[model samples]
Target: MRADAKKNYGRILEVARTVIAEHGSDASMRDIARRADVGLATLLRHFPTREAMFEALLCTNLDALTQKAVALESSNPPDVALRSWIREWVEFARSYRGVVTMMAAAHTNPASALYASCAAVHSTSARLLSNAQAEGTARPDMNGDDLFALMTALGWAVDQPSFAPRADHLVHLITSTVLLGRVG
Candidate 1:
C-alpha cells in the first residue's frame, strides 16, 4: 500500500477499536470513517466489509490467545490450563458488545473472515479438554464444541447488564463445572 493509504488504514483501525469498544460489533462503518476523518469510500476501499474490518481488528488478539493457550498447556496442569484458557476466551468474546453472536456464526462459517481464528481457538480448546479428560480432571462426555458453546454462552451472559455484575462468579462456576464434572 502507498504511505498515505497505509496511514489511513492504521487510523481507521485505531478509530474502529474505540468505536467497537463503545458501540460493539454492530458499530457503524460510517461512524468509524467519520471518526477517522476518512471518506466512507476510503474506509470501504480499505475494509470492504464489516467482517474484514473486524478480522483486522481482532486477528492480533486472537493470535495472542492461541499462543497463550499453548503456553498455559505446557506450563500448567491440564485442568488449570483448560480453565485459564476458557476464562480468557470468554473475556475475548465479551470485549466487543454483540461479538459473541458474530463469533458463534463465524465458528461455523468457513467463508467468514473470523473462521481461521475461531477454528484455531476451537482446536486448542479441544486439545486442552482432551488433556483434562485424559487426566480425569474434566468430564469424558464433553468435547471441544461443547466447551466453545459454553464459552460463547457465558460471554453472552456477561455482556448483558443483568449478568455483568456476576461475571467473575459465573466464570468460576463454569470453570468449576468443567473441572469437577458437576455443577455443585
Candidate 2:
C-alpha cells in the first residue's frame, strides 16, 4: 500500500471501529466509506468485505493484546496472571465496544481468517486457565472454553450503557467468581 493508501486504511480502521461499535458487524461498507471520507470503491479496494475490515482492525489490536497476555501471564502469580488477562480483555472491549459482540460472533461464525486469529487469542486464555487450575486458583471443573464464555459474558456486561466508566467492575466480578478463590 502507498502512503496515501496506508493513511486511508488507517482512517478506515478508525471509522470502522466506531461505526461497528455503534452499528454492529453488519454495518455497511458504504457507511464506513462515508465515515472515512473515502469513496466506496476505495474502501472496497482496501477491504473487500466487512469482516475483512473488522479483522484488520482486530488483528492489529489483538496482536498487541496477545503479547501483553504472554508478558503478564509469565510474570505474575497464577491468579494475578488470570486477572491481568481479563483486565486486558476489558480494555480491548472498551477501546472498541464492537469487540464484545465480535467475540461472540467469533465463537460460532467468524470468517476463516477471523476464526483462526481468534483461536490464537484464545490460546493465551487457555494457558492462563491451565495455570490457575494447576495452582488451585481457578475452578477445576471449568476449562478454557468455559473461561472464554465467562470472559465474553463479563465483556457483554461491561459493554452495556450502564457500565459506563465502571466497566472494569465486570472483569473484577468475573475474576472473583471464576478465577479467584475469594472476593478481595
Candidate 3:
C-alpha cells in the first residue's frame, strides 16, 4: 500500500473503532468515513464490505485482549494475575457493548477470523484460570472460562440501565463467588 493508502487504512480502522465503540458494531461505514474525515469511496476502496471491516477490527481487538490475559499469567500470584486479567478484559469490554457481542459472535463462527481469536482467548483464559485454581487462588468450584464468562456477562450487562447499578455488585459477586477470599 502507498503511504496515503496506509494512512487511509489506519484512519478507517480508527474511525471504525470509535464508531463501533460508540454506536455498536452495526455502525455504518458512511458514518465511519465521515468520522475518519475521509470519503465513502475511500472507505470502500479499503474495506470493500462491512463484514470485512468488522472482522478486521474485531480480530485486532480480540488479539490484544487475549495477549493481555496471557501476559497476566506472568504477573505475581495466580489470583492476582486472574484479577488483573479480568480488569483488563473489563476495560476492553466497557469500551463497547459491541466488543463483547463481536467476541461472542466470533466464538460461534468457526470459520471466521473472529472464531480463531475466540479460540485463543478461550485457551489462554483457561490455562491462566487453571493456574489460579491449582494454586488454590481461585474458587475451587469455578474454572477459568467460567470466570471469564462472568466478566463478559457482567460487562455486557453494565451497558443497560437496569444493570448499571449492579456493575460494582456484579464484580464483587464474581470476585467473592469465584475467589472465595483468595484475592492474594
Candidate 4:
C-alpha cells in the first residue's frame, strides 16, 4: 500500500473503533467515513463490507484473548484458568456492545469475515473447559458449545441497561453454578 493509502486505512479503522464504541456493531459506515475525514469510496475500498471492517477491527483483540487463554492453560490450575478466561472473554464481548451477536453468528458461519477469529476463541475455550472437566472441576455435561453459548448470553445480558449493574454477580453465578457445578 502507498503511504497515503495506508494512512487513510489506519485513520478509518481508528475512527470506526470510536464510532462503533459509541454506537455499536450496527454503526453506520458513512458515519465512520465522515468521522475519519475520508470519502465513503475510500473507506469502502479498504473495507468492502461491514463484516470485513469489523473483522479487521476485532482481530487483534480476539487474537490477544486466545493467546491469554493459551497462557493461562499452561500456568494456572484447570478451573482457575477457565474461570479467568471466561471473565476476560465476557469483558471483551461487552466492550464492543453488540459484538456477542456477531460472534455467535460468526462461530457457525465459515463464510463470515469473523469466522476464523471466533473459531480460534471457541476452540481455545473448549480446550479450557475440557481441561477443567477432566479435573472434575467443571460440569462433565457441558461442552465447548455450551460454554460458548453461556458466554454470549452473559455478554448480551450485561450489555442491557437492566442487567449492567449485576454483571459481576452474574459472571460469578455462571462460573460457579453452570461451569463449576457448585452453588454460586
C-alpha lDDT of all candidate models, in order: 0.90, 0.80, 0.74, 0.91
Select the stronger candidate by TM-score from 2 and 4: 4
Instruction: Estimate candidate 2's alpha-carbon lDDT, on a 0 to 1 scale.
Output: 0.80
Off by over 4 Å in 1: 181-184
Best by lDDT: 4
Candidate 4 segments exceeding 4 Å error: 181-184
Candidate 4, clashing residue pairs?
A: none
What lDDT tens digits, residue by residue, belong to model 3 across residues 1-184? 8999999899899888888877886798889999899999999988887767876776777788877766777766777777777667666677765667767666667876567767777777777778888887676777656865777686788766687777666666666666646552
- Across 12-101, the per-residue lDDT of candidate 4 in tens digits comes to 999988998899999999999999999999999999999999999999999999999989999998998998998898889778988889
State, as a TM-score between 0 and 1, how close model 4 is to the true structure.
Answer: 0.96
Question: How many clashing residue pairs appear in each of the predictions shown?
Answer: 0, 0, 0, 0
Per-candidate alpha-carbon RMSD to the true structure: 1.8, 2.3, 2.5, 1.4
Please, what is the TM-score per model? Answer: 0.95, 0.86, 0.83, 0.96
Model 1 per-residue lDDT tens digits across residues 56-130: 998998999999999999998898899889888878867778878888899889999999988998899899999
Predicted candidate 2: what Cα RMSD to the true structure? 2.3
Q: On residues 108-179, what C-alpha lDDT tens digit does candidate 2 reach at each position? A: 565554786677767789899899989998888888888888878777777777875676666677888877
The deviation in Å at residue 150 for candidate 4 is: 0.5
Worst 10 residues of 3 by lDDT: 175-184
Best-to-worst order by lDDT is 4, 1, 2, 3
